[model samples]
Target chain A: MEKILLKNLGRPGFHTIDSCLVNGGYNGLTEAFKHAPESIIQMVKDSGLRGRGGAGFPTGLKWSFIPKDPTIQKYLCCNADEGEPGTFKDRGIMENDPHLLIEGMIIASYAIGASVSYIYIRGEFVFGTRRLEAAIKEAYEKGFLGKNILGSGFSHDMYIHRGFGAYICGEETALLESIEGYRGQPRKKPPFPALSGLYGKPTVINNVETLACVPAIIEKGPKWFSSIGPEKSPGPKIFCVSGHVKKPGLYELPLGTTMRDLIFDHCGGMLNEGRGLKAVIPGGVSAPMLNAHELDTPLDFDSLAAKGSMLGSGAVVVMDESTCMVKTALIINRFFSHESCGKCTPCRDGTPWLTNILKRIEYGNGRPGDVELLESLCTNIFGRTFCPLGDGAVMALRGALKNFRDEFQHHIDHKRCMVS
Target chain B: MFSDKAKEEIQQVLKKYPNRRSGVMDVLRIAQRERGGHLVKEDMEEIARILGMQTVEVNASAAFYTMYNVEKPVGKYHIQVCRNISCLLLGAENLIKHMERELNIRVGETTPDKKFTLSTVECLGSCGTAPMMQINDDYYENLTAEKIDKILKDLK
Candidate 1:
C-alpha cells in the first residue's frame, strides 16, 4: 500500500534537483556513503530484494558478483533498454521518476564499488532519454553525481548511453557490447558480466526498476522492505498491466499479489461487458501464457515458475474471447523475427520459419503436419540459441500451441481462421 | 559528400566521441534527417566519403539500424504504431484498422495524399500506455479510435 518507489512521481518538478531534494531523494545515497560498500551490500542481501527485470535474480547477489579487489575498475550498467514485447514499466520509472533511478544507481554504484555507471536506454525512448539526461545533468549540477558526493569522499560518475533500438541489447552481455560502442550482440556467458564485461573488466547490470528500488531499500531498512512481499521475492514491483483491461496502465503492487487482484481489482477487469478472461501472459511474451483457470496464481518469480511461466519484466497481457491465438502467435513471432540479431542460427533461421508457418496457418494454407512441425521447430530452437531471444520465441510458440491447439486444428480442418 | 549544414550538425555528434570513426552512425543519422527521412544509395556513399570511410562500411551501418529509412520514399508524417504483444493485446488491431480507414492506406504503404505513412513497429517501450502510436518522434499514448481520429485530423 505504501508508495515508496513511485512517491516522487507526479510531484511538480520531480525531475529537477530542488524538488527531488525536497522529496527526500539522495538521502539513501547520503546514508549509504557513511557505511562500507560491503555493509551496504549485506543490507541489500538481507532485504530479500530480487531484480524486477523478468529474470528475478537477487539484486544483492548480482552486486556481490563484482570483484572485491579495488585494483580493477568495475562498471555498473543499468538495463533501461526496455524492449520486451509487453513491458513498459521501465519507461514509466525512467520518465516519471527519473531521480529515483538515478539515486538508486548512485546507491548501487556505491554498494558495488563501481566508479562509473551507464544507463543504457533504448533509442526509441526519445523522451525517456531526454528526461534521464536532464536528471543526470541536474544531479551533476547539484553535486550528487560527480566527485565527492555530499562531502562523503565517495566518488562516482554516471552517463546515459543511448541504444540504437535493438531489442537484443536488452540482454546483459549484449548491452555491455553496445555500451562499449559496438553492434549490439550477446557474448558467451560464464564470464557472466561479473567476471569479464565492458572492456573485459568486472561488471554488474541491473534493470531500471531493479536499481530504482535500491534507494528505497536503503532508506527504509531491510526488515521493512522484506515485510512487504512474499518471503523470497519481497518488495514492491511495478507491473505494467496492459491489453483488454479497462484501466490499462502501470500498477505498483507487492510481489505476491494474485493475478485476480492485478487484472480485476487494479486494472478494472476486461474492457468489454460480456467478454470474460480467455488467457493471460503474466510476464511479457517470453513468459508462458496462463488460462482463465490459472487466474488465482500469485504474481511472483517462484509462483509463476511453479506454474510453467516466469515473472518476466512484469508485463501482464490480458486476452479475451475476441482475440485469436494463431494471429497472436504470428504477431509475437514477427517481432522476434524482425528483432533477432541473427548471430545464432536457431533464432535467425527458426524465428522466421516459425513466423512463415504461422502466417500460412492464419491465412488458411496450413498443411496437415504444420502444427506438429511447429512443435518440432520450437523444440530445436529452445535452449540451443545464444541468448534468451530464441528461447522467448520458442516459448511464445509453445504457449500458443499449448493453449490454442484447437485453433491450429481448426485452421487445418476448416482451411480458414476460426476468428475471422 | 555531406553538405556544410549537415557537416556542422555532425560536428555536434563528433564532440561526444574521441575518434572520428565513432561518429559514423551520427553522421548517417544527420544525413538521413537532412534528406527528409529516407536516405538514397548515393546518400550513404556520400556519408562514407565525408566520414573518410569505405562506402560498404556506411552502407552496412545504415542497413543494420531500423530507424534509417533507406531507398523508399516515406510519407511526410510517419506513424509507427506498436503492434507487438503489449500493444496487440490492447487493441492495436483496432488501432491499425482505424489508421488504415482514416488514412485510406494499408500497413507499410504511404497514403496517396503523402500526408501519412502507417507502419507497425515492434515495442516502442510505452507498453504501460498500451495501444499507443508514435507520430514522428513524439509518443501519443492511451490510443482510442476517437483519439486517433482527432490526432490524425489535427496533423492535417
Candidate 2:
C-alpha cells in the first residue's frame, strides 16, 4: 500500500502552504465540501478505519455518535499527547507533516458540524509544538481555518493546547479535563466523549495519527482504504521501532506486517549478529511483551489481541539478551507509578507498590515469595480501577513476569541481575 | 504581574475559549515565560486577578503540573535527559551518570554558577532516537559521550 498519510514525508517545504498546495493538500477538504455532510460521514463509515490510538474503535462510527442537531456547542480534539513509553509515531506526523493533520481536522470538523478544533499536545513536545503552531498560523493566513473557510460558508478555528507534563492526559476524558484547565484526571464513562465532551458539548477526540488518516479517506473512497490491510483494522500504520536495533525509527507500512519483518527487515535486526534477542514489547509499555520466538505475530489489533497482547500505538520496542529483564520491568513500573493520575485506589496506590516490589527484586534483595507477590499485586490492580491505566499496567508487568519468570527467579535466587 | 504584551497575549489566549477557567493553563504558561522560567505567588495572584480565578486556585495549578518550574531557578541550560524504558535500554542511566561526573552536579541539581541544570524527564516521545536529551527547546538525539561533550562546549 502506498503511504497516504505520510505522502509528503520527506518533501522539502512540505509544511508550507505553497508546498501543500503543490502536492494536492487540502484537496480532500475541497472535495469534501462538495458533498453533503451526511455523505462525508457515510464515506468514513464505510472505510472501516479503527482508532489508531490503541483502542481500535471505528472512526466513522465515533463521528456518527455526535448529535445531529446542533446543541449548545461541539469540539474536535486532536490527542497529540504522545507520552506512551514506546510510542512516538504521532510526533512524527505532527513534526514532519503538520498540514496533513490540519487538513484532516478541517474535513472532520465539517463532517461533525464543529466550529472549533484543538490540538492538545504533550508539554515535552516543544519541537512539534513549534511546527504545529507555524502550520496553524499558515493555515489561518491562507483562509483554510477561519471565517468562511474557502468560501464554503463553513468557519472553523483551530488552536494548539499543551499539557503540563502528565501522561494520564493522553486519556481522552483526562485530555478534556486538562483543556478545561483542571487537574488532568479521567472522569467516569457511560457519558463517553462522543455525547458529552470538551466543555460538556458533543465532541469527537481522535489521536494525531488517526486524524492524519482522515484526508486520505476523504480523497480516496473508503473502499480503497479498507482494502489496504486486514478487513477489520486496515490502513497504513506507522510502527515506531527503537532500542537494540541498528536502524531505529519510524517505518510506515500496511497493517498485519510480522514482528520479525519489522525488527529484522525494516529496523536492521537486533544488537548484532552474535547477540540473541530476549523479548519484544510489541506495543507501548502498557501492552504485554512478546517473547523473542513469537516474532511471527502479525502487527495488527486482532492478531496481537489473539496473542494476549495489543498493537498499542504501534510502539515496537525490542530488547536484546544484554538488556536486564528485571530492570526493564522496574523501568516500566516506575513509568506507570509516576503517571498514575491518583483518581482511583487501584492505579494510584497499586502502581507504586508494584514499582517498589520490582525495585527491591532488581536491587539484589528479594524474598522467596516476591515473584508470586508481584503476581498477586498485579491481580489486585488489573480490572478493579476506574480507568484502563490500571489494567494497562497489570498487562505490561504481569506479561513480563509470565514470559520471563526465569529471569525473575534468577534475580531472587542469586540475589543479583542476570544480565551483568 | 504580566507585562502589557504578555497581558495582551493572555487575553488573546482567553479569547480562544468561552469560559475564562478554560484558559488557566495557557495563562500560567504565559506568566511563567514572562517571569523568567518560573512562577511566583504574586504572579499567580496576578493571573488569578486577570482571569477572575482565586489565587489558591492558580497556585495549585502551577504546583500540580510538572512543566512549570517554581520555588527555584535553573541554570542557563536545562539539560533534561530521557530515562524511560527504551532510553534506559540504550544506556541513558549511565549517560546521566556520566553527565553528573562531567558537570559535577547530580540529577535535579543546578551548577553552583547556574550555567547548567541537569535533570531526568519522562519519555519525550523520542524513543526512536534513544539516549537523547533536550536542552531548552531542542532535542539532541543519538547521544554519546563525545556528542555530549560537543553539545556542552557548544552550549557555552
Candidate 3:
C-alpha cells in the first residue's frame, strides 16, 4: 500500500526541510490552518486513527480530551522515548525524515490548543536527537514554528527533551515526571494527563508514530485513511521485523495484514531454512507470543487482542526453532525486571522474583512446581502494579508457558535445554 | 564546578523548558559529558545549585536513569553492547564475549589505558541490525569478530 508515515524516508536529503517541502511536507499544516481546531479534531476522529504506541487509543479522542478553554495552559508531548524492546519504528522516523515528525507535531499542537510542546526522546538516540534539533531549527527558520505560522493565529513552540535511560518513562505519567525532572515513575490515574498533566496543566502526550500520522490524516481525507486497513484499526502500520528473519527491517503495510504474510512473504520467512519458525512476538516483547501454528492471525489491535495479545508498537519478533523458548522467556522477564520502576511494591518485588525463577528454570534447576509458581506469581502481579509494566512481564511469560509449557517441563525433567 | 562554556550551554538548555527544574536531564547530560563520561558529586551539587534543586534531588534523578554514570568514570570510547531479546536471539552474547576477550575488560570495566569501556545495555533500539554496539554517540551494527577488531584497532 501507499506509505503515509515513512513516505519521506529513503529520499535524498529527506531529513532536510527543503526536501520535505518538495515532497509536500508542511502542506498538512497549511491545510490545517484553513480549518477550525474542532474540525481538525473531528476529521481525525472520523479517520479511525489509533495511537501506534502500544495502547490503541483513538488519537482524535485523545486530542478532544484537552480542555477547550484557550486561557488555561496546555502542552503536547511527543513521546520519542522508544525504549520498548524490538521496537525501532519511531527511531526510523526521527532519524530519517524528522521534518515529517516536526510537521505532525505542529499540526497536533494546533489541534490540541497547545502553545508549547516537547519531544521527549531517549538519551541514547544521540544521532536522532541531533537530527531533530537541526530539523526543528530548519522548521523555525521557515516560520513553521514560533510566533505565527502561515498567517495562522496559532503560535506553537517545540523543543526536544532528552530522557535518561529509563524504560518506565515510556509510560505517559512517568514520561511527564521525567520531563519535570523527577524519578520516572507512574502516578495514580483519574487525574489523567488530559485533565491535569505537565506541571498540573492540561497536557496531551502522543507517540512519535501517532503524531506523524496526523499530517497524513489532515492532508488526505479521513475516508482515504480509514479505508486502507481494517475498519476499526485502519491506516498503514510500520511493522518492525527483527530476529530470525531473512529481511529484518521496517515494513509499512496495512494494519490487518496476516502474521504469516508479514514473516513469510514480507520478511522472506525465517532465517534458518532448516529449523523453521518457532514463535512470533506480534508486538514488542511485552505482547504475548504466537506459536508457529497461529501465524494466520491478522496483525491488528482488535484481532491480536481477541487472540490474547495486542498489537503493541508493531514490533514483530520472529524466533526460529533453534531458539530455546525457556531462555527467551527468561530474557524477556529479565528485561522487565531490570526496567521495573521501584514505585509499586508488587512490580518492584515481583519482577525480580519472576526473573529469579525463570533463571533457575533456564539453568535446569527448576523444580516440578516451578511453572505453577510462575503462574501464581503472574496472577499476583498482573493487575496489582502501579502500571502495565508488571502486567507486560506476566503476559509475556504466560504466553511462553501457554505455547511452550513443554519446553519448561523438558528443562525441568531432562536437566538441559530442549532446543540445544 | 563546570567550565564557563559548559555553564553557558546549560543556560541555553534551561531556556527551552518552562521551569528550570525540567532541564535537569539535559543539564546532567552536559555535566556528564563535561566530566569526561561520568558525573561526580560536585557536578550534581553544581547542577542542583544551577537548577535551584536540592543536591539530593539531582542525585536521585541521576541515579534513577541508567545512562547517567554516577560514582564511576568511563574511558574515551564507551562501548555498550545490546543484550536484549532481539539481540540475544541473534548471538549478541558471543559478540559481547568477543569484545571482552579483545578489550581485556569485563562487561562493566574500563581498560588499563582508559581508552575503552565495555558495557552491556538493555537495547539500543537497533534490533533490525542485530548484534549491534554503540561507541559513544555512534552506532556500530551488524557486528562480527573482524568488525569488532577493526573498530577497536581504529579507536586504539
What tens-digit string does per-residue lDDT give for candidate 1 at A1-420? Answer: 988767655665666777778888888888888789998999999999898877888889888988899988888889998988878888888887899899999998888888888888887888988899899898989899889888987788887766766888889998876665456789988878898987788888999998988887788889999999899989998888878888877888999899999999888888897998899999998898999999999999999999989999998889888888998899989999999998999999999999999999888899999999999999999999999999999987788789889999899889877765
Clashing pairs in 2: none
The residue ranges of model 1 lying beyond 4 angstroms of the native Cα positions read A9-12, B1-27, B40-55, B111-115
DockQ of each: 0.55, 0.83, 0.89
Per prediction, fnat is 0.61, 0.82, 0.83
> TM-score of candidate 3's chain B against its reference?
0.96
Q: Report how far off residue B6 is in candidate 2 (Å).
A: 1.3
DockQ of 2: 0.83
The lDDT, on a scale of 0 to 1, for candidate 2 is: 0.89
Candidate that would win on lDDT: 3
Residue range A266-343, candidate 2, lDDT tens digits: 888886778888899988999899998799999999999999999999999998888888889899889888888888
Docking class of 2: high
Candidate 3 local lDDT, residue A57: 98
Tell me model 3's lDDT, rounded to 2 decimals: 0.92
Q: Judge the docking of candidate 3 as incorrect, acceptable, medium or high.
A: high
- After the best TM-score superposition of candidate 2, give how far the Cα of residue A328 lies from its true spot, in angstroms: 0.2
Which wins on lDDT, candidate 1 or candidate 3?
A: 3
Ranking, DockQ, top scorer first: 3, 2, 1
